[model samples]
Target: MQDVKADVYVPGHGPILKGASALDRHIKFYKDLRNIIKDAINDNIEATKISVPDTFGEPDEGRKNMTVETWLKFYG
Candidate 1:
């Protein structure tokens, strides 16, 4: 918010919000990403949480890789 001096913002997967609601989605997004990556790691398809959409940092070297859909199912 500081970057834009704005009070509200819309998250990637949810609706826009102007106050605590915005914060709620932000936190959930992080938690969701965490679970997603954890599942990937458990399944041996390494992944990590990140700020930007489809923009995770380097994941651990793995023997195989998969599509985002696969990750979502694993994550869900």
Candidate 2:
């Protein structure tokens, strides 16, 4: 979107966003998630033990509803 210089962004869920500033939170969320997963892998933590933090913000309902076990099976 930013590469394309789109004026508006539509996510898979939730309300539409406008402009670069609107993407800040989402960009941070992805960056944080990447860091979390990397650290967990480095620590040899089981995927089943990993949980998304509340500080990561409200996940989509589908993701919010997914269990840790489900995530493990999906990612592992």
Candidate 3:
């Protein structure tokens, strides 16, 4: 996104985002989530015990457990 120099971003979901700052925030979000899951795996945290930060934005409650399960399947 930074290399492309786009003025706006159309995400897979949610409202349309504008500006580079929006892209930066999106990048940070995924990076943060990846790191959190990685750390949890390293610490031997159970999939059922892993948690996302409350401040990470409003995620779908129904998909939260599935997300953790998918992450563990690939990275665990």
**What TM value does model 2 have?**
0.54
Q: After superposition, how far is residue 76 of candidate 3 from its true place, in Å?
A: 2.1
Best by lDDT: 3
Q: Which candidate do you rate higher for TM-score, 1 or 2?
A: 2
Please write out the lDDT profile of model 3 over residues 1-76, one tens digit for every residue: 5777788888788667798888877787667778879999899988777776544565686677887888777777
lDDT of each: 0.52, 0.65, 0.77
Stretches of candidate 3 off by over 4 Å are 11-16, 54-56
Per TM-score, the best of the predicted structures is: 3
Candidate 1 lDDT tens digits, 5-63: 45777657555767765566666655766666666667776333322233334333341
As for TM-score, the candidate ahead, 2 or 3, is: 3
Arranged by TM-score, best first = 3, 2, 1
Error of 2 at 65 (Å): 8.3
Off by over 4 Å in 1: 1-17, 46-76
lDDT of 2 by residue, 1-76 (tens): 6676777899888668787777776677656666666677668787655656565465666675464445444445
Per-model root-mean-square deviation over C-alphas: 11.0, 3.9, 2.4
Candidate 1 C-alpha RMSD relative to the actual structure: 11.0
Worst 10 residues of 2 by lDDT: 67-76
